[model samples]
Target: MTRQRVSLRQELPLLVWLVIVWGALWQDFSPGNLLFGALIAVVVARLLYLPPVELGGRFNVLRAIPFALGFLAKVVAASFQVLFLAVVRGPRVISAVVAVPLRSRSDLLVTATGHVISLIPGSVVVEVDRSTSTLYIHGINVRDADDADKLRKEVRETEAGLIRIMGTKAELSALNQEVGA
Candidate 1:
């Protein structure tokens, strides 16, 4: 009983989430649904708390909104560019996978980098080497070395800014130093 009390205190958010879920279910309150929802919520809450990567921090989520918007714009522009290249150049356009170095150390940051690149129209994350912190991206219409380099730069810059906003102080400092070096 004492141990349960202490653990519950440490996981107050989970308790609050349980209460919210119970209240919602209780209103309509089907017995089967209530049991299922409670079971699922308990499992999810336990999983959320067990992760070694601390998700809580004093960070600005609002900053990420602009980053997402900018990324969306870039995706749209790239889509149109790819369409134009496909229609105008046909079989002559070159596509190649280029390896990109990532500065952020967090798994979340790295996953976000891959996801964002994959979301872009003319680009896809073809491979990721987590051990080396590198991403291999396939770029459509990558005319030459210059175009590939430019694409890599743009992806790095965008990911760097997002990482700065989302990452912990230690991570942000390391990432900044890596980018600088």
Candidate 2:
């Protein structure tokens, strides 16, 4: 029988998260509970083993700090702003799908941008054109083309940070230059 080796990179962190979640869910540690937790851990590890993009593997935790903090602040502020618009202004307020041309070449950055947009209350990522590197985002409160453009810039910055965290500084710099041009 060939021995299956588990890499610490792939297994340890997953195991920790599993254990913490398991502990929270079950106050009593019976045999069945232990087995269930182990099964859950195995399933999670299996899923982690097959990530859609491998870019997150190189994620620099330090570079991610600013993005995480900024994302939280933006989300909180946007939530209230969106709520106010929704409550005060009826559905007559403008909404449109704007195409944002992505600067970063990495699929991870593109995906991250889509996710961040979706997380915000007023916007949703409808589609991403991988070949053209453009994001189609539906904005509920977009007033004009300028608003759409501003949203695109914000998304680009957030995604650029993700690229930097994933160790693509050179690629991101080139992308930034292209955007500037």
Candidate 3:
């Protein structure tokens, strides 16, 4: 398949993120190291024939700040919950694999939601149906139908939060409409 040529402007975010990750991995953010990382980032981006990742061309830092904080809080809470479950429930903890259908069809939104859900200690995304934008999340301590429904709600809520943070305008509008309804 012929790949559409992506402009440097369109690809800048990926290149910049790659450089930051490279610097972080090496634990060296010195100018020389960052420059080297940037050089490698550009080379990898250019050499790889991956499809372009389309961004929304906008990001809401205000929205992201709260989302990030909430995510951190969830991580902490889930970590303790997992530890408690392991100690208390031991071998009898109930777990379920639940399918969550997300509102956004964008691959980025789906992937981001999956990561957020998996980052929480008690749950991990086992599979993704990209065509349907559905996530199969395996969650520990989900003992009943109510728990499964709750998980699905949380997954969709995460996607909604992401849509608020960096989704395309149309997606944002759709989310607003859904909430409004």
Candidate 4:
């Protein structure tokens, strides 16, 4: 079997991110330190069996800004909601592992959506069914079918927002058609 050729453009983001993380870890911003970090990053990138991350080739900053703000708001509200549930329901808080079937089959989008949902309080991704592009999320205060439906809807909406921001044109078109229909 032959290895797939990876373009420099595809690898650059990972290398740059590695350098930034190295610098952050070392708490150094000096030019010499950064140069050294860059060296290490390049060496690591070459030595590691890294998988290629497919990019959308276009990013919509305008779409990203609103999504970010909305995510922050959800974080805040979920925090308060979790706090309320903890105080009122305590150990008796109703929780369920709700299955959320996502539209996008892209690993990047599905993972991003799972992360965004898990970052907010009261829910966490318990398992991911990559074969089905599904996320099984354990949610707090999900007492019935309605609550579970809301959780699934919330997770899918997050995926839609991510798709709008940087999804491939095909994915965006499909999403648009789905919404229009």
> How would you encode candidate 4's per-residue C-alpha lDDT over 59-134 as one tens digit per residue?
8999999999988998999889988887898998889998888988888888888899997766899999999998
Local distance difference test, each candidate: 0.75, 0.76, 0.90, 0.89
Clashes of 2: 0
Better of 2 and 3 by TM-score: 3
User: Model 2 segments beyond 4 Å from truth?
Assistant: 1-20, 27-40, 43-52, 167-170, 173-181
**Cα lDDT of model 4 overall?**
0.89
What ranking of all candidate models by lDDT puts the best one first?
3, 4, 2, 1
Q: Where does candidate 4 stray beyond 4 Å?
A: none
Cα lDDT tens digits, model 1, 1-181, are: 1222225444555655775678695675677766666677677776565533343243566877888798889788878988898799988888989999887666877888888878775688988899888999999888799989988987887677766677777777777788689
Instruction: Give the Cα-based TM-score of candidate 3 against the true structure.
Output: 0.89
Pairs with backbone N, CA or C atoms under 3 Å apart (clashes), candidate 3 = none
TM-score of each: 0.69, 0.71, 0.89, 0.90
**Candidate 1: regions farther than 4 A off:** 1-39, 44-58, 175-181
Q: Give candidate 1's whole-model lDDT.
A: 0.75
- Residue-pair clashes per prediction, in order, are 0, 0, 0, 0
Clashing pairs for model 2 are none
The digit string of per-residue lDDT tens for model 2 on 78-146 reads 889888887999777888898888766668678777888788657888888999889998888888988
Error of 4 at 103 (Å): 0.7
